[model samples]
Target: MADETPPVDEMLYEQLAQDALRGVIRSALERAALPAGIPGAHHFYVTFKTRAPGVSVPPDIMAKYPDEMTVVLQHQYWDLTVEATRFSVMLKFGGMPKVLSMPYTAVTRFYDPSVQFLLQFEAPATIEEIAVEIAAMPPAEVEPLGGDDAPKVVSLDQFRKK
Candidate 1:
């Protein structure tokens, strides 16, 4: 058997670009902490992996979610706190202000329909892998900058390896 396929890995660039965009999620959350309020209808469409490490969604919410969940951040969210490593916020779930604390690593998507700005990220491959990695990593390992080891920069060499 002869293999005629020339190994091409163009999609690696897309992954890198996608990760770069996901960094904006952290930036937006930082801006969100500016005062104590958001402006206009600039709400958020936040989606997360419920089973990610350090994720605390209400049990009922978790029951309904099972694996992943989407939350609308507008009109009723309060006590939004954004720190370099993680964030905590109060949002009404069925009229009860249940606090949900999330690490950025748990967030899979961040979208602001108001301006059409969107960013999406993923946890390498699988759920169990993500959870294990998150639990094993120290706070200093993912702090967005020097505290975290910076990001894993994708190299073009990957495409040239063949």
Candidate 2:
């Protein structure tokens, strides 16, 4: 008897679907960049690979969260700029201010708690690969935060397939 399983996917449909979803993130950021900023009661928790390509953050932050980090865009954020492939913003960590620039490809998850919106992306590089890559890069500027306030983060480990 012949096997019933379908052939492998040559069209890369999964990748295409991920790309389309990333467009949604890009669009939301664009809207958030508007003068009015994100509409009433809507905020985001964006999680990304700390060492992914095109990601820039303070050395202390990268050192603290060598694998991944989640940032909240809420009451205290500045210079929220979105470009075609990446976005940059100023956010406070503890009491210190830092700027982060990240490409959409680096994002693993995006969630808006107020509206219960969530999106998860396929990481282009594995954690081991990211570690190796980060080792090769020069250290970024460091800033120390003195306060106890930390952004709330939601992990996707439970949602990932084992």
Which candidate gets the maximum lDDT versus the true structure?
A: 2
Q: Write the per-residue lDDT of candidate 1 for residues 85-142, one digit (tens) a residue.
A: 6788888877888888877777788889998977777642335764565577555433
> How many pairs collide in each candidate, listed in order?
0, 0
lDDT of each: 0.72, 0.85
TM-score of 1: 0.62
lDDT of 1: 0.72
Alpha carbon lDDT at 120, candidate 2: 92
The top-ranked prediction according to TM-score is: 2
Q: What is the lDDT of residue 85 in candidate 1?
A: 61
lDDT of 2 by residue, 2-87 (tens): 77998878887877898899999999989888989998999999999987778998999999999899999877889999998999
Candidate 2 Cα lDDT to native: 0.85
Question: How many Å off is the CA of 36 in candidate 2?
Answer: 0.3
